[model samples]
Target chain A: MQYIKIPLVLAAVLILVIVFRNRQRVELRAGSRVLVLALAAIAIVSIIDPDIPQAIANLLGVTRGTDLLLYLLIVVFVLTSLGLYFRLRDTDQHLRRLVRSLAIDDAIRKDGPPRSDADLGPDSQST
Target chain B: MESGPTRRNDDVWVIVPCYNEGPVVRGVLERVREHFPHVVAVDDGSRDNSASEIAAAGARLVQHPVNMGAGAAYQTGIEFALRDPEAQIFVTFDADGQHRVEDVMAMVDHLRKSDVDVLIGSRFLGTVDGMSMSRRALLRAAVVFERMTTGIALTDAHQGLRVFRRSFARVLDLKAHDMSWASEFLTRMSEHQTSYEEYPVHVLYTDYSRAKGQRSINSVNIGVDVLINKLLRGR
Candidate 1:
């Protein structure tokens, strides 16, 4: 039990460290911050007592406490991965737009205005 | 939106998005200039003197701070061209010289006479000289993927040559900043319900173009990007 508790505590601290480290960059919303903190608390309590998940699992008709925790962890993992994926995509689009706008601005500054219609018209040259 | 100063006569501004085509860009611009002097070449942060070559050729040159990709460069050129009220017609020509000057003239003539808002150059419909078998198959596969994604049946879905009118330019808001934008352009045309026509255009496959072109495996990335863009943007 002590051996199990050691690894569980280490995992929780590692998750907290990661979340904190990336909190600024990820721009986690208020709700997400609260949810993460709550998840961390639950993880700590479950590691210490080892019965809370079992009780909850019993109410939910699950056979084992570990199984319930594992299932929950899987759900959390998927959700987190999806959240990060969306964030990365959003950042990529924002950056591309920035670069595009800069390029367009440069073109406008250099060219000033478009050429006259007669000058650029098809009548100007023949293939 | 009511009509304003944005309207003008049919003037063709050739938008050439170049990336490190230093060796051949000068000749390509010279040929294009012979027919259409109103050219805007967007240099996508080439390490070589591509920008200088474009400027020396007497065409308007736009430089990107970094290599954003061909799609972004196209958007920049389009936006720049849109600034001129007299710039009614916009032609997208490749800087690699694969596209002929005659094709652009034909497309512009067809576009003005026809009712379509956009004209796409089709290599399969016309002729692809000196094309490799593997490249031909890849382009065929691209057509399938494009039809599946955009629901617009095009013989050559990835051809860089196109003629877009003034009205179409206002509605054409391209978001793809990479090679995948070619596929996205078709999807946009379909999604916007813009009328388009595919015209036969001759494509000259050269050794330089073959080496400088998009790799075959990059087709997978384009496919995935198209899927993701369709799902996210619903286009």
Candidate 2:
């Protein structure tokens, strides 16, 4: 019963992911899918062979498998936080680029005259 | 500064893509208004007063109700420029003030004389004074990566300061919604066999721009997207 519970939960999660993917509103990338599959596979393997959890716990200097699960969750959370940080940084860069583009376009729109070619230095010329 | 030969006015449309740039949007728009008469600012669903500020600056504004990626905003601006009969050339300028107003003329001149469809700005071509060493190195690495991946020789592959002729701009199917759009643009140019040039330009990295700079990890995300686009999207 204990072994069956892990696979059953994983199967449920997989089904849910598939259903969400089929809706097409939010499609997971192949890399993300692979990550999810790997996670599920690890969960299944740990369930089928109870010794795996004990080994992980011993490796981590923990006495209980539950402690191992807790450590794993903490690691996952840390990674998720790192991912979010990167995402926000990307958003900030995109915003700045957009703002700069708008500013230059605005400048050109207000001034009707073409800039003199002499204004641009020789080094500025396109190759 | 020695001036190059002047080109016709009908050949270029300067595109500015903005998002929530309420404070400085007015100034940037005003500058564009003064220099490039044919300017289009695509408001990428700015949550603030960006769209209104752009409209107030006397430039044509294309508003996206929600914030799409910079790539989407550029595509919107390009579509607007392509619709105009006078827009024979399209230039992508940032809403921030990193790119100089004078550099646009140089790019346009190069595009007009050379048998090329695209002109990119290269900060490394000449002396780069105001940029940080870290940024300079990172940008150089990105350029090398792009050259290896796309087989296009460019001094600055990711610079936003670029000019494209109508013939090349019209055929581009730029689908990337994020910063990877820059790479996607290069990939499209390579696929279409569009002629291109790299022009040297000054990149002013102000405190504001530095604060808004992307972390190095985002480059990894962009790299992943590039690989996916090339391998999966088959671009």
Candidate 3:
């Protein structure tokens, strides 16, 4: 009966995630998808064999399963941070290209020829 | 065959794409007139007095009714320049006074001597001063990434100061509305096997230039644009 409950919960969560994935604004990246799967596995394993949580808690010198959950939350937060970092890096590259193109466009529109430092006054001269 | 001086006159049309640059538009026009006699400035629907300033400066003006991206403006300028029979080379100049006039000459010389179809300005080639450290780092990373993706070992892949031969420019199908046009250009150039040269050019990073800049956060939006255009739109 106990093993049956674990599989049932796992199936329910998987269906819920699939349904929500389509509607959610923040779609999961490949890394996040892997993390989520790993988490789901852990959740299912915990339900099927509750002693696993107690064993992890003991390994970490924690007294309760809730303490183990707290550690897992920290791990999740770290993974999310890593995901955000990669996303931001991708954004930075995109912006650099945009600025370069815009700058060139602005220059081209004004019928301006390319300018040297001598044109911008001596103070504005690039070193 | 005509002499070297006469042959030089047969090539090169300066293409300028202008937006809301009312203040310094006149200066840019005067500079181009002094150096390259044939210059065309395309006004990309500036809400400001950029168009009038361009006309007053006495350069041919191609106007777009609504504000389009730089890539669109460049395309317009190229189309107009292509109409001229004397224009054998089409050079893209920035209106913001960042690129050097001498670089255009150098690019022309390089294209004429070499078998390359396009010559791009590279700030990282020889010496680059007055660039912010953060900007330099960002640009270096982008150059590496672009080189990796396109297999083109260019020092400065995104520099807008480019000189394209009339023949190559005519065949290019540049349809990018926004900044992704630079990447698109590289992708196309590689696909078409267009020979290109990367020449060193100066980059002047002024307070005004940086102030009238896009926010760093907009990079995410640009990345999304690239992914969508490349994958979803099948471009």
* Highest TM-score against the true fold, candidate: 1
- A19-38 per-residue lDDT for model 1 (tens digits): 54455554556758888999
Off by over 4 Å in 2: A1-127, B1-8
- Model 1 chain B is weakest, by summed lDDT over 10 consecutive residues, at B1-10
lDDT of 1 by residue, B1-235 (tens): 1222122223678999999999999999988877775788999999998999998887888788888788878888888788876778999899998999889988887888999999999998999889889989999999998988889999999999999888888777777778998997888898789999999999998999988998999999989988867655621
The number of residue pairs in model 2 that clash at the backbone is 32
List clashing residue pairs in candidate 1: none
Q: What's the iRMSD of model 1?
A: 7.9
Candidate number that wins on lDDT, 1 or 3: 1
Candidate 1 docking: what grade?
acceptable
| C-alpha local distance difference test of each model | 0.82, 0.73, 0.70
Which residue runs of candidate 1 sit more than 4 Å off their true CA positions? A1-38, A54-71, A116-127, B1-10
Query: Whose DockQ is greatest here?
Result: 1
Worst-scoring 10-residue span by lDDT in model 3 chain B: B1-10
Task: Tell me which of candidates 1 and 3 scores higher on TM-score.
Answer: 1
TM-score of model 1's chain A = 0.60
Q: What share of the true interface contacts does each candidate keep?
A: 0.50, 0.00, 0.02
List model 2 lDDT by residue over B69-115, tens digit each.
88878887786676665568888998877778778877887778898
lDDT of 3 by residue, A1-127 (tens): 6689898989966654453333223454554577689999999999999999999999878999888898789867865674565466446446534544564555546544333222232343332
- CA lDDT for candidate 3: 0.70
Estimate candidate 3's RMSD in Å.
12.5
lDDT of 2 by residue, A15-93 (tens): 5445333422334446557777888998999989989988988987899998888887876686567456546645755
Ranking by TM-score: 1, 2, 3
Question: What TM-score, to 2 decimals, does candidate 2 have?
Answer: 0.64
